[model samples]
Target: MPVRSPSLVELNAFLAVARAGSFRQAAQELHVTQAAVSRAVLRLEQELGQAVLARSAGGVSLTPAGTQLRQLVEKPVAALQAAAVRMRKTPERLRLRLSVVTSLGALWLMPRLEAFHLLHPEVEIEFRQYHHDEDFTRDDIDLWIAIKRSAPQRWPRHIAAQYLIGREVVAVCTHERARTAQTAPLLLAQPLLYHSNFPDNWALWAQAQGAKLPLQRKGAGFDLVMNLIEAARSGMGVAIVQQCLAEADLASGRLVIPVPGSASTGRGYFLCRRRAQDAHPAAELFAQWLMQQAGAPPTV
Candidate 1:
């Protein structure tokens, strides 16, 4: 018997689940509910009369049939999505989708967006949070504010990349935590916490400071820099944080910059988008406003 065609929603849900390996994560990726994703996958399984995914305590894995289906439909679905993007009629209202790195979005931009809304009440911004490891080239998103580690020049050539803030980092901890740093080499013996994305941050900062920091795998690590900041502010440990994001905390006395010299991690946050002509007008407006907000010069 021929494999019956699955609904587009079912196929999309299955693909998201397969890529993420968890229905909850897939729902997040698809911006849908976990139950909705589960239902779609179940409907797809029933339509196929076979299990496509193997769910376990660890997570989810693709079955043989799932693997085959993914190999067949992934490119087609991507093309379909791209085609839909191209086919969308430009809305009369100036609206655009902007994907922002999670930490920056929450700590940096979220506070400053009211100004943008006031400046361009005609423009509407749809916000999405992006992760470090995920694909960044979705056509549906009009702009991306992302962190680039090195050679920011080559990222997305032929596109606009305005480096908002140079990756200037500082060692920060609550004021009370600094008093207990008797351990030699500065904060090494403390309950050192870090954002998981930059596991070598402490080592890098130490290296930049002309000190040796042994590889450390101990203590709490968080995915979001905001959480790392919270943990540090709660006196959990010293965290190497991006200075731009930690400015408010440092100013408000929530977090204290304990380290003497700030280290440049060679990472920078960039405001990126398609070419001006090809980009949404609202995205361009937001991008320009954002550059001004960061006090970074606009790029052509």
Candidate 2:
């Protein structure tokens, strides 16, 4: 006779028995009788034409075939269980979860969020800051804002992205420093503040201006652009930052561009989201609003 396939009930019973090492214990765990658990496991063994468990006075133990099956199904079963738990915990309200760089969130998005709220009061928003690299597919992120030299070549195939705005890097410092320095070389001589993520920003800006910055100079380094801007504003040092991030400070006279020209990094920010059969209404609304704010064409 040909071997038959085991049913889900039988497989679950076998797994329970293998884990507990006893029909009585497995039955207790499953809230079923010992005879029912034994019958289920026996049915599975008969279908597969294998003695899946060994019975002895000491206790029950899985045979080689049972061990192999357990190993194959454990991860998939765990994943299903986890997915079910997530579905149960998800809220009913429309929520958009966005992951963004710390500086952009603080300087640009936060200031404009209230307007979005007023317009779409029923929609909820959650912002998460990722200071380091992240796997967008595995995280519970609904969308992401990424800054790159150009469109990323190695992004996951499941994600769709649209260009938002090109970044213009400019050197900025307090008004006092601006008054003291009349030339690019003088500005470069001050303690240069550095953004940890874009450590070569100043050097790149200098190279764009047909000048070379000394790499040997020591400066205060901050992981977040907002902190670097604050350091520059406090007169600690001159910092090379994205022009968009310091627009308010520059307009308010708290900071000044020490250099006359800004360097185009040939880079821009991209709005990214997973490709799905249908877009979430809240996410779509926010994405469109973001594009409008960035001066980009609205996403369809």
Candidate 3:
């Protein structure tokens, strides 16, 4: 026998009867006559070749087939109803989805998000975090903030990339460690913290100071900047991190820059978007605001 598809109306009628256990009650809930609800379910049974409901003097009860069908369609039907309601409510509101690095999202973006919200209460923001080398093309992301050695070259042809902010790498430690009599050599002897994504940060800083780091230096490694910064603040190790991420910790006296100066990594943060699609108005505004906050001039 051929598998017949039941209409959404029929499925809805069946579900109502199954939930209420009475065709009359289901009809009342659906704003239809009891006979109409019964006819819809009968038509559904004919298509499926199974008697789904067992009518009783008290009320209708589900047969075995009806129980299985109800279990499968219940949640999906509810989800569809919910989606319809949401569509009716905010069909025009702009939903801007962004992908950002974990550390940047936690330390920098989250703090400044309130300002964006206050400026555009109508816009909704969704955040997605991507770690090292994760593919962004399939993510359906509206915008991306990425740290790169230079402008990205491997992005899809439709993607537009713009330089956001250049980062300065600095070595930081807990306030207690900063208070100790520490020299560059002494600091190198201490356990150094490293980011898994940027493992050579300490070496890069050492190179900027015209010194070669020892091959056997002790250190702890973390996959995220926030974790590395926290580890440093907890006195676990000395952390080499971007100046932007440590600014708050430094200002609050939780962490201090043990090193005197920063190293230029020839790298920077970039804002990326798909060029073929019209930019979401909210995303454009947020991008401009981000540039303003980073003190970078808007690109033409």
Q: Per-residue CA lDDT of candidate 3, range 36-87, in tens?
A: 9999999999989999999888779999999999988866765565345345
TM-score of each: 0.61, 0.62, 0.62
For candidate 3, the 10 contiguous residues with the lowest summed lDDT are 291-300
Top candidate by lDDT: 3
Kindly report which residue stretches of model 2 are placed more than 4 angstroms away from their true locations once superposed: 1-93, 129-131, 149-153, 296-300
**After superposition, candidate 3 runs with Cα above 4 Å error:** 1-92, 129-132, 149-154, 296-300
lDDT of 1 by residue, 1-300 (tens): 975689899999999788667897677656678999999999999999999999899999999999999989976876575445445587356787888888788788887888777766667788866756634566777888888865433665335566788577778898888777534375676777887877767777777777767555356899888889988888888888887788778878888766577777777798766542352556645655675678742111
Local accuracy of candidate 2 as per-residue lDDT tens digits, 158-212: 6666667646789899988887755777777788898786677788788888776
Q: Candidate 3: lDDT over CA atoms?
A: 0.76
Position 220, candidate 3: lDDT: 88
The alpha-carbon lDDT assigned to residue 234 of candidate 1 equals: 87
Clashing pairs in 2: none
